[model samples]
Target: MSLLTALEDGVAVLTLNRPEVHNAFDDALIAALTRAYESAIADPAVRAILLAANGASFCSGGDLNWMRRMAGYSHDENLADAEKLGRLMQIIDTAPKPTLARVHGSAFAGAIGLIACSDIAVAVPEAEFAVTEVRIGLIPAVISPYLVRAMGVRQARRYFLTAERFSAEAARTLGLIHEVVPAADLDTAIARHLKALKAASPAALKATKALVAAVDQPLSEAVIADTARRIADQRASADGREGLSAFLEKRKPNWGQA
Candidate 1:
């Protein structure tokens, strides 16, 4: 299988298994990833989704063979192919459960979209990132929305146009990832985040994810009203009441029990 899916202690782990090619995006891998992500998101037992790869490089972007095949594709064929990749990115971006990327080595071209779509991304200090579509006489069209959202329009414009490789530190500075840890401590970092996430009420986490997306737009009367309604709805939820009672009673809340 090009992708491996496993559920471990509430985290749905999706591992890119194509180490030989640095887990490049072939059509099969793309389809497998899309299905895995969809499955993870829809599984009620899954509290978080983790994207990882077993290789020296995370993902080097489009597979050469796939690109070669695409070279001879008609306009409609290419459009369909791009849509599949775009849908995969969209699923990760809008997952109700928390989504994280565990990155190492190099992440180029389309791989950047996977990282950008994640709610939290942790990369090794040696990890590298690039938007290299322009270098190949193509644009980073499908992943543009997520990339722009993650890194901001200014940084996106520069990287998209220049297609320059950037270090993990630079990626963090640009908001492409949340943290840069040494390779040796990558798993530890992931565990720490998972632990924190597990402590939160699942319903609250989902609601909060939705809240962030809702408020990411320009503030307005509708935005303010939506925020007020969300808070009110949360307060009235069973988990919300339990959370408050647990806090007052000096005990941990039963997160997913409600």
Candidate 2:
């Protein structure tokens, strides 16, 4: 299997299994990831989602053979392939549960999109990043929106055009990742985030994610009203009441304690 999935302690971990290829993804791997995300989103037991890879490098982007095959494909065929990749990115970006990426070694080309789509990302200090599609006569089209959202248009412009590699610290400066820890502490950092997520109400987390998305648009009277309604809805929820009561009572809510 190109992807390994496990549900443990309310976290659904999706591991890229092709270490030999630096976890580079092809059509099949893309399909596998899309299915994994869909399943995790629908599974009630899954409170969080983690994307990790078993490899020297987190991901080196598209598999070389996959690109070679695309060279022989007609325009329509290429479009279909690109669409599948796009869908995978969309699924991760829009997941209701909190999503995290554990990045290491290198995240290049499309791999950067996976990180961008994730709600949070943590990388080792030695990890590298690049948007090198332009170097190979291609544009980072499908992943452009997520990349731009993660690093803003100004930084994306420079990297997309220059195809220059940047350090993990640089990626954090651009807001592509939240933390740059030592390789030995990578799992520790992931555990801390998972612990924090476990302490929150699952439904509230989902609602909060939706709230963020809703407010991303231009603020209007409608948008403001929508925000008001969202908070009101959550306030009326069972978890909301429990959370408040627990806070007043100086005890943990029904959810796990951090």
Candidate 3:
């Protein structure tokens, strides 16, 4: 269980278990995470996915050896390797279920991508974050989409250029972390968020997320019409109808029930 995954009461916990290496991403780590995410997305019992890492720190970003291997490759080969990491980020970003990143310690470089991809993130107050790519003469390009979107252009400008390490409190101020808790109570804190997520309808949650992201995309008649149709279809679905009914009936929605 190097990449531990468990679906309990509608929450899929995806724990990065390679504490021995600071949970850095080598080929094995990427493959394990991709598999766990795919499983979480496919499991109907899972309403949300939580990403976490064990050990004193969270992910240390790319493994140094992994970088050294990439450093020897041609530009095309390097891009290919980067794409693999990008794909993992995309899978987490567009996961049909909601995602949360629970960071207990430092999250650096590509590790920030993980937090950025999560729909919600809660980090321990002592956790640190940095975009350390520039410190090693590399650009933080691959993670630009999630990073820029998470921190916005202004904040990305500061971090990407300076490569400065910042605290979790600073990340929250920049709108990255939804909340912060002491390490002593991180589990309790994450559980509180998951409890709220559990109360939501899975399909409705997915539909709502889609709506939120798409509703403001460059407005065109086709975009508006397509989105309207998409929402209308979901509103009439089995889960959708049940969700509305459950609210009126004052009962939990049928999630995790066969």
Candidate 4:
């Protein structure tokens, strides 16, 4: 299988295992990833997710044959297929649990969407990236939401228009990679983040993530009031009180207690 899912110690790791093709996505890979993400969401035991790939490259984006297949499909079929990819990206984007993209190498086209949807990304400095769609005569409409969100309209305009290759450093500068580490130390860097995540409360992490999604970058008064309401609710909740008490008393809150 090109995709594999495993859960251990409250962390779910989904590996894109198609090294022969740099984990380029096909319909099957898309379906497998969707199922794996859904399973992680359904399983309360899963507190975090790590997206990594086997091979010298993280992902090559759309498979050529798959693109050919889509090129020949009807418009309606293409729309439906696009929806699947969009849904998978959205699921990962809103997964409640934290998501980390472990990119050791290049990520292009649709493949980059996965990274953009993640909460944190740790990539090797040498890892390359590109929009890689205009070169093939297709617009990156499907991946636009995540890609634009990650790189913003200004950066997106340059890359999406040029479809030019850029280094991982450029990606990091554009707010894509959270940290760009040496290739040999990529996994170690990601592990450090995972370790810190593991020490935090899963429920608190989930709620915090939800809050971020719900109220990031908005300066509207309504949003401010709504955020305050949420904070007040958390302050009075069992988890909230326990977390506060633990901090003040210098003790760890029992996992189930909050």
In candidate 1, the residue pairs with backbone N, CA or C atoms under 3 Å apart (3 or more residues apart, or in different chains) clash, namely none
What is candidate 1's CA lDDT for residue 50?
96
List model 2 lDDT by residue over 1-258, tens digit each.
899999988999999999999999999999999999999999999999999999799999988677656655554566567767877877888899999999999899889999999998999999999997655445677777778877889999999999999999999999999999999999999999999999999889999988998887522334333433443343334554455455445676674222
lDDT of 4 at 253: 60
For model 1, residues 141-201, the per-residue Cα lDDT tens digits are 6777778878889889999899899999999999998999998999999999999999999
Best by lDDT: 2
Better of 1 and 3 by TM-score: 1
| Model 4 Cα lDDT, one tens digit per residue, 1-258 | 899889877889999999998899998999999999999988988888999999889998977567656544554566567667767877888888899999977799888889988999988878999997544445566567667777889999999899899988899998888899998888788888988998999889989988987776523334333433443344344554454455445676643331
* Candidate 3 backbone collisions, by pair: none
Overall lDDT per candidate, in order of appearance: 0.82, 0.83, 0.76, 0.79
**What's the lDDT of the predicted structure labeled candidate 3?**
0.76
Q: Cα-based RMSD of the predictions, in order?
A: 18.2, 18.2, 17.5, 18.2
Those runs of model 2 whose alpha carbons end farther than 4 Å from true positions after fitting are 218-258
Every model's TM-score:
0.83, 0.84, 0.81, 0.82
Ranking by TM-score: 2, 1, 4, 3
User: Which of candidates 1 and 4 is the stronger one according to lDDT?
Assistant: 1
